[model samples]
Target chain A: MLLTLGIIGILYVGILVLLALRARTDVKSSNSYLLGGSNLGAVIGFFTFAATLFSTFTLLGMPDFFRVHGIGAWIFLMISDAVMVFGLIWIGYELRKKARKTNYLGMSGFLELNYKSRFAGIVAFIGVFIFLLPYIAIQIRGVAIFLHATFPEALPMWAWAAAIVAVMIIYSEIGGLKAIMYSDVLQGILLLVAIWIVGYNCLHHFGGVTAMFEEVEKVNSALLSVPGPKGLFDFQFLLGSMIAIVLLPYTQPQVSTRIVILKDIKSLHKMAIGIGFFAILVILPTAFMGMYGAVLYPDASTSEFLNMTFISDQSNLIGAIVMIGLIAAAISTSDSQLFALGGELRSILKGDDEKMVFLARIGIAVFAISSLIFALLTSDELVLLARTSFAGTSLLAPMIFTGIFYKNAPNLTVIPMVTLVALIIFVASLLNFIPNHFLGIRMDLTLLAIMTLFALVCIYTDRSKRGGAIEN
Target chain B: MTNERIWTLCKIAVVILIILTFTPLVTPSGIHKPAFMGLPYTLWVGILEAFLLVGITWLATIVHSGRHEE
Candidate 1:
């Protein structure tokens, strides 16, 4: 245990210094700090994108999914990411270009520009805060989970989270995105290697792929189901996964930075495919490891499944290995998220209203604290939260989709329709007044349908104005 | 392409991308995501906002340069 911890500790201190030093150069202004001066190149872009994708989910929650279900759980995630490839190409590539032209630094800024309504910007700002806080909460939960399970007497998860949050804050303070991408590159590499080891071990344990699948079949037939145990096949899970894939990380400020980071359209294509392949390869193993856990541990609770089931021994070596990957995933994502959080800070709170690095740093701290609170407060495990977040975004789909399906939308109509969708979702979540599925359709699907109808009518009714509004 | 054509194409491409990202190929599941990582998905979507930006801004730069030449 000591030996493994020593190795991981040495790695942490050594590489972190190098990462810090890299960011030391050209560290100035929120622009360069937040977006890397629109100068992030191919290598950094790829890793940052990959790192951004890591999050705690990759390191921890995926194994939980596997232990709960089987090989099929992994297939769902891999397929979702695969499907996400197209969505990223379609959404990310062009949005990067438009944002550059408009000088839109944040999502709110883009909507403001497109809709020609400051209200859209305000709505965006509020929406961003709502989504980002919970995403951060999960990271905190992973940290807590790690400390809680690994150590007989761990530091309070809050203290550990605060310390972890503090380190991220310090670097983000000094380097902005430069710190993030550099660290991300390092974290990205660690995650990939660790994933390989874990995957190899799991496959070995399972006696190989053929035997593994057979065992999975032998186990609960539900593991073979499309959605896995929790009715993942229920209309809600399928459609929710679709909406979540596109809706979640795609909108983040750090993600937007990658758009500008691309050298050209050709590079954008490469980054997309590269990141997609990497995400698949990396997540593929982790998810499969989950299946291995399902085979090994069988019936285990979702939260404790990864460590309780996957890791047989709590000795330092295994702990160090998992910790390294977990930290890599956490730091890589949190750092990027920190930078993106800064971008939104300027957009919603500052936006030509103010520019204070100190203020942004303070905001970062607040964000971390809030995330810690939310994680501790919420009882939902990783997958439940993942599904819930997906539902939230699917609700917003039609409002934005109108730009694709039609060329016009009337604000008078759109404003109310978007309001209606959000209101309905808020009500649905709070009241559970209706079944998740309506008329043999998932409620989320129903919501999307309604969203589409409203968007279409708005566009159709407002189309003739000739560049009259936020539509194509 | 003329400067105007470039701007037009750039604008069109960007618009198409945004629509594509937010809209799904298949219908959605009723599951609602209250937040990701802790923020709304819209906040996360800001990352791609840069892509739309670069294309259109480049087009504008080109157009502005043409006007200067004119």
Candidate 2:
């Protein structure tokens, strides 16, 4: 445990030092700090986007999901991610075009300027904060739980959570978004390498990939098929999940910000394609790991399965490195989210650069602390928690889509009203005031459909009203 | 090809991808009974779909970006 912690400590400090050196203390404007001066290249852009989209979820949640659920887990995440990457090509082009037109600062600020209403921005900011805080907490808590399960004597869960949040907050403060993006490049590479290394080891233990799956089939044929032993991955669930993920870059500011920061449309295009490949490569190995778990520890609990597979099954050095990789994945994602929340706050503030930066830093600390609190409070269902976050933020999708595609939307007030109502309905469902699925459809999909129809009505109403005024 | 034509094709490609996901092409029942390439039909189809999207995106980039110099 000490050796593991020592190695991770060295890597963490090394990354911080690299970022500190890369940090532009000369960032004289909020633009430089917030958007990295919109100068990210295709490589960094792709890595940052990929890293932000994946996290400890890919490392921890996915293997367990594949183990518990089945191939449907692949359809749930891999296919959805693929669709999202394809969508990004066009959306990135259009969003960048609009950003150039609107002098975009942040997601909320973009909405505010386009709608010509501060209320729109505030609603967007609130939506992000409400959804993202829990999501960030999940990432922090995921690693905390894993580490706690692995080393019961090392540290308490809250300490692990706080340590990550503190490191994220401090690193994000020093290097800002640029630092986060740089670290993402490192994290992305490490995640890919670490997963494959561990996956290879797991596969080797069972002879090979096919041999592993064959063993899984022998143990439980259901494990090798769709929906696995559990029917969690049904049509509606996968469909709703795909929509949420496809809308992710638009709704998640950390991801959307990366989209906007690419140097050019072509760069964004390349980044999108690269991410599709990354999704495939990163997710394929988790299936191997999952198959290994299915054969070795079919009846084990999620934590036990994870602890045994990641820690006990490997050499001490490899296990320690893999653990650090898990930590890296969690912190990489948490920092981007924490920093993006700060960016959202910066967008809503009306102060000068210095004042806004100061306040945003303070906001980062506050939000991190809040997320740490949530990490302590929430249960350890990482994938479902993440899905809820995705579904929640996706309620903002119609608002953002309208702002992106339409020149004139109905009363700016109407969209936010629709958004707020949909949010209420969704939250009620989440809180069990209402059922989460109705007639085999997820509440989120139902709300998204209703909200989209409302948006269409607003657009048509605005168009007709304009036509009538012109006739007059 | 003209930039407009390329973008139009790209849009169509995206629509097709969306339709594919919604269709039984991705459903387990669609490819569950057969094993082509030593994997479940649904699984390979999903993988192929992802590859096709990436392929399309790459081609679209080449086509659309080619005209950027014009």
Candidate 3:
């Protein structure tokens, strides 16, 4: 079973490599390859966005969250996905318009010109790197776990990780954005099919979502509430998670590029709606799969629920389909982030397009390597690691909110505000100093709310400045 | 800003507020608890996914309308 899965991984990677090289022929025209001539119609845009949002984490992780936290994780998870759609609907359209008019080639390029400060550009660059690393690492790690589970004897986890990395990077380097989007189009289809199939069978196996919950509630009453079993949730965490939701969509570089790359407003909005629906559908089932696992393996830990009963309980062929979904998820997650990482690194230094692209490829490896180390080294609970990984990037929310909405946000204030706010959340979450439960809520809940408030104030302040300057 | 942007702001505000409302309700419930309309809220989190659907519809209308100036 493991060997078959390993072979599938190699085959998928090989296909991606070929496609990427085809796209690579145009890499010299970075803009065209990266943005696909800025002519991506609704179909392509939707698939790419779907691939970007419906990550492997959702496929493999959210069900686990449901197992541990009960349906409460749904509140946090749903809200986050919904808000990302809301954000894209507005900002994405504006970004598309702005990019077209400004000839803004990338986010950093836009910031440098808009703020008249390279520091702003540099902050955008550095901010993505710091925040996105864990996000990417988790994507890679999830794939590694999936591979390890399926084919433990076929290869070392590290070797599996290397194989996954090589495949993604092949097309990532080859066709740039176009290649990735193209692959995402295929992977997106695979993901959708597998998610529905697995979700359905799990629900059927367990006798349905309602009966499944009856058993789960017996396992733990708290599973129905915000704090669940781990005792890690609270007001702070709740609020933090909310912000993470709004903030989550923008963190991945590929998402940000969609704003600039999308050809027109009509198509972009269509893309957003399509992606939103697809994402909501794909993710909600994983939660049900958790509910399904509830009846089958009522005593399992969240991770065990996700990886074991829900995923592996099925026949080997079925398991391979699940693995394929995960690989697509991992590749989609990694490729988009790596592409964005490439752009972010390029933004750090101004001259020489070829050099910037080269350095960007190198940056992808650096991030992958670091994440590999962190994956092997950290004994942290996998679920908590995901949330903590989330906290690390909570810093970028404030900065981005300010950038998009605040026209006169002081150049000096952007980085400090984002850095400070995110860091505080990270520290508070780590120390467990914040209330793990807030007003009957989990900590992820609290953390999300705090970040939202911070973003609003800074962005509002920036907006007020624009009005004031215009009036003056 | 137009009513559209105003609506966008309102939508963002409403979403955030909804999240706040959920703050008090963050206590664990069974994984299969049904939400409004008989949908398991966990599976249907996307229904109320922060007006992403509404927001997208709005944007699509704007884009297709060709009301946008370059």
Candidate 4:
């Protein structure tokens, strides 16, 4: 097992280094380095988007989500993902149309350009920086904890995390988005293969799907239904999850950047469709593995169940591959996110292009180090923490969408101001300074609803005020 | 119908599907019967729902008004 892991690990790192070197040769300017020349094909776009969206969260966090939360995890994630893909084709087009009108570098700068206010861009940057740090942390922590569990006598969890972060920072700094995308292709394939192999084995354990669910039923019938025993999948939670997820491409800079860089609308459309299928294909097996856990290791800790199911229960070769896949998943997602935040920083900066890009590279390293520190301190509830990140970033949606759609967004500085206030209140709720629920509705849902209404009202009033002036 | 109208219909269809997903029709609480092909209730239905969404997305791509835009 050790030898196989070492060989595969070396091969994976070798490919990543080669890809970085190749991408470095293509980096003629800041634009090429940052945005991959803004001409990505459909197949690569789909794989990169998939690899970024479905990360260690899917491979490590999701099966546990299903095991703990029951079948509703499907409704929570996969269904939301399906809707998100559809949204990518629909609203994503509008975003590209708007972004192409400017020298698009990142979402923050785009928002600044649209709102005609530097504060708007700053607000956008702060929201993502505050939320995405924990998200990137979990990706590191998820794989780090799993690796620690696998090799208990090896390095500590923080050391594992630092190693992962160091590898990610070096490769992404050497190459750029292109290198990350190239590695994403490899990571995406490994994730799919490793997951399906384990999923198939788990399903085979009970002879078939029928016997599998039957065994799960005998252990806990609740695991086969909505809300499970924990009642965690109520309507509000599911609804909030869907809204947050569908808005991700708009709200999350990492995903929104992918939309802008697609070669054409046709490629974007194809990529959206492909991602929907990929979501189902990737998430379905997690359900099988989850049910397998529900029947066997129903009460194991997240790391325990994952280690036992993904490694201990499998053959040495398969276990080695799965371990490498986990690392790949973590790196693929984390690198894109850290890089995207840097792009956001660049978008808001004003200077020579070369200097700005150089500064953004430094910003990427800073963000990576911050995320590594957070990874060492964050809790192991990967799925919930990820959902919090999603919800936190979704608060930026109304501000972002208004900037994208409203022709007079520059005059509507009020939206970004209110968005900042909403972000503060949401963070307070997360810190338990206030209740997470307001009047029985989740704070995230309540704030998003209010912000959407506020944005619409602002748009209407601005239109009305303009009409009255024209009449006078 | 025109591609624009078909696109509108696609959006409406997705909205309706999303609404139904929250209701008992797709995720009935504590009810895991009516198994299909040996799969549980919500799981099978959820899987089917996901497929339907992807199918709609695929269809939407063909009829999308911006498909010809660069």
Best by lDDT: 4
TM-scores for every predicted model: 0.79, 0.95, 0.82, 0.98
- Candidate 4 local lDDT, A160-273, one digit each (tens): 999999999999988899999999999999999999999999999999999999998999998888878899999999999999999999988999999999989999988998
Using TM-score as the measure, name the better of candidate 2 and candidate 3: 2
Best-to-worst DockQ order: 4, 2, 3, 1
For model 1 chain A, where is the 10-residue window of minimal lDDT?
A: A401-410
* lDDT pick, better of 3 and 4: 4
Worst 10 residues of 2 chain A by lDDT: A463-472
TM-score of 4: 0.98
Per-residue lDDT tens digits of candidate 3, residues A43-68? 98888878876676777777766766
How well does model 2 score by local distance difference test?
0.82
Evaluate model 3: give its lDDT: 0.64
B-chain TM-scores per prediction: 0.44, 0.74, 0.35, 0.96
Q: What global local distance difference test value does model 1 have? A: 0.60
Going through the candidates in order, their DockQ values are 0.04, 0.43, 0.29, 0.90
Highest DockQ scorer: 4
Higher-ranked by DockQ: 3 or 4: 4
Off by over 4 Å in 4: A26-28, A468-472
Comparing 1 with 3 on TM-score, the higher-scoring candidate is 3
TM-score of chain A of 1: 0.89
